[model samples]
Target: MILLRSGAFFPLIVMSLAFASLVLASLVTGAANVSFEDLLLDPEGSSLLLVSRLPRTLAALLAGASLAVAGVIMQMLVRNRFVEPATTGTGECAALGLLATTLLMQNSSILAKMAVSSVTAFAGSAVFLTLAHRLPPTQPLLVPLAGIIYGGVIGALTNFIAYEFDLLQYISVWMNGEFSGVMQGRYELLWASGVLAVGAYLYADRFTIAGFGKETATGLGLNYKSVVVLGLAIVSLITSFTVLTVGIVPFVGLVVPNIIRRFKGDNVRATLPLVALTGGCLVLASDLIGRLINHPYEIPASTVFGIVGTCVFLWLLYARPQRRV
Candidate 1:
């Protein structure tokens, strides 16, 4: 416990420092090279800074934090460290909803598309939870495997529809993660995830107890069903908001939380704040490196994360010991 707490606490401080550096880098290191002097001295430059870089940095931080928290909550709820919004079909459902809105409505705005996407993603999460309830609880891997299979089916259906309708390009652009386009008024949807993250912190204990098992949680006087539903709802909201704003940044929800738990233990309540901070730092770092590596071109933050996370995941798989749960 002492080691875990120490490990958990120190990373938060480091993450905070890294986050600040990344934000500063994001503002100054862009293609235009808007300096601090330009931001302070010129009105038009100041507006550009506020309108462009500030919002994008904020969006990246919020998206990272929200997705990380959602991942932690989901791992607790399903008792599976590998499970995440993307793996569980929430992202695909959101994409389907957005695609449907664009095809059916013909004149739907981004907000309208996001609203529909959020609703559908919530429904998809509900389906996963329901399936979880019906299945005989066994190993943690089985639960996430079910979710992965479910998500795969949904994703395939989505791809088929997009192909049939000749909207593959639109789907392709939206499905892959990209932060280059974020600006003021465009990334506000991510604020919803911030709200949900707060709610998750408030109910962290319930989630911890619920993770012990439904019967155990019930015996402990916690409302297991309600807690599970609340956690799922938060995950759905976070996932949908992220998909709508920056597209799918896969493995964040799955990888970050698991990595945190190795050092912090499975104390969801105590670990959430650190998870959020570390997630933000990781994303910001990835975004900054992506920008610098290609100089003027800029790689997607998601691509960086994917490469880094896959390696980490492989290491974990190799090092992980078999356990009796």
Candidate 2:
């Protein structure tokens, strides 16, 4: 118990230190260099600090936290830690929703696009769940594999539409995560993810129980179906908001939760804070590195995460024990 608690608590501390460093890095290092003294005294420096870097950092923090939490919830509900929104079709569905709305409405507002994308994402999740429930128990991996295939189908459809309508460039732009454009008015959409995160925290215990198996959860007097639906809804909402705000971030969700579990065990409630902290730190670090590495022309944060997370995921595939059914 002591060792477990120590390990769990240690990551939170490390993440906090990392987060602080990233924040300072964001403030100190940018396209235009403003000295500490100038940043402290100059009105224009202060405006840049408040208007630009601050919102970017907050967006990164919120996006990371939301994606990580959504990944945890999806893994628990599906009982597969390897599963995430990217793999399970939620991101693709949201992108498809955006594409459909763009094609149909031509010039819809971001808010309308978000609403359409969120609903489409939720519907995709519902289909996945329904199919999983109907699949034979002997083929346990079939469901998630099906989700991947389903996502591929949706992605192909999205591509077809984008190509046909000559909107491929627009699609590509929104498909990659970028923090560069985040400003004060634009970032309010991310607050939806924050609200969903709070909902996840409130229902954390039910999720933990649901992971034990539907029958067991039902035996415990929990409304298993409702809980599953609610969790999926929250996951869809977070994924949609994330895609809307900064585009699709691939594996922060998958990587962060597994890393947290290494130190914190598998208790959802106990691990939530660690997950949030690690996610925020990882995104912040990636954003800072992306900015500094290219100087004036910045790389997207998702690209950095993709490179790092892919290597980590490959290592985990070989190093970790297979999950028991």
Candidate 3:
């Protein structure tokens, strides 16, 4: 069965509870002294919650879930466990597009910027996939290595452009994933990425079939190229939305889906929700930890996750059982 089986019940409930608790913590965990009593008695407190806490929390959850799902799709399409949007130049290209929009059309709305970013991201992802296709399929590590190089080149170009135009600050903001600036009316665009994650789930079976390679997918009556394009579109849009909204959160996509797949296996339909939930939990918890660690000031969620995700990635690379091809 492609749907979640009975065996998934306990873990699903446990993760759901954990996600709920994190949501509660995120809703209350911020500066400016928000409390339950304030919510009932103080208009200012309620306004702060509406304007800041709620939106930031939602942004974290949405970005985490969508990015994680996008990672799963990328892994399946590319047939490699180590690759993700940040590695494949999707986020970098999105940032590039954002920089171009900011420099050229200073009055552009966020939607306009996001539209441009998505286009660039899609092109970048398509290029990465094309390069991956030409690599030696027998060497699984080559795909991600190539992706890292590709992303680095694009990132360098982005940095150079930002430097030339004195927009390094803008680039810095987009490259570091943080929620300190998130507020109502500013972060709602992430909901579309969440919707795209749902779209991924609806196409889960096809993606799973596509993971088996083009010949296999074609024999299975799946349009392999179309599936790849659809997956890339979802990944690009999610990457663009997250980059434009909360900056680039490294490894949420890479680490979460890989962790979930280790235990849940490669069945996309069965594991997608768990991956999404785990990713949301990881980001929300990181955000909460970032807030508490500094008290008044803040650490970027990306910085916090980069430390933790790096360790996890190394463990997955070395300490774990041998990887699948």
Best-performing candidate as measured by TM-score: 3
lDDT of 1 by residue, 163-246 (tens): 999999877766787789999988998898888898899998888898888889999999888897788788887887898889
Best-to-worst order by TM-score is: 3, 2, 1
Between 1 and 2, whose lDDT is larger? Answer: 2
**Model 3: per-residue Cα lDDT over 118-139, one tens digit each:** 9999999999998998999899
Q: What is the C-alpha local distance difference test score of candidate 2?
A: 0.85
Model 1: runs farther than 4 Å from truth? Answer: 1-8, 109-111, 132-139, 320-325
RMSD for all candidates, in order, please.
3.1, 2.8, 2.7
Which runs in model 2 stand beyond 4 Å of their true positions? 1-8, 133-145, 321-325
lDDT per prediction?
Answer: 0.84, 0.85, 0.92
**lDDT for model 3:** 0.92
Total clashes in model 3, counting residue pairs 3 or more apart in sequence or in different chains = 0
lDDT of model 3, residue 101:
97
Which candidate should be chosen as best, given lDDT against the real structure?
A: 3
Judged by whole-model lDDT over C-alpha atoms, candidate 1 comes out at 0.84
Instruction: Please write out the lDDT profile of model 2 over residues 1-325, one tens digit for every residue.
Output: 8966757456566777888888887887788889866777999988888888788989999999989999999888887777788878899999999889988987899889988998999998888777666877677668667878988898888889899989998677667998999988888888889888878988999999999889999999999999988998998888889888888888988999988786567889989877877887898888888998979889999999999999988876678654644
Clashes of each: 0, 0, 0
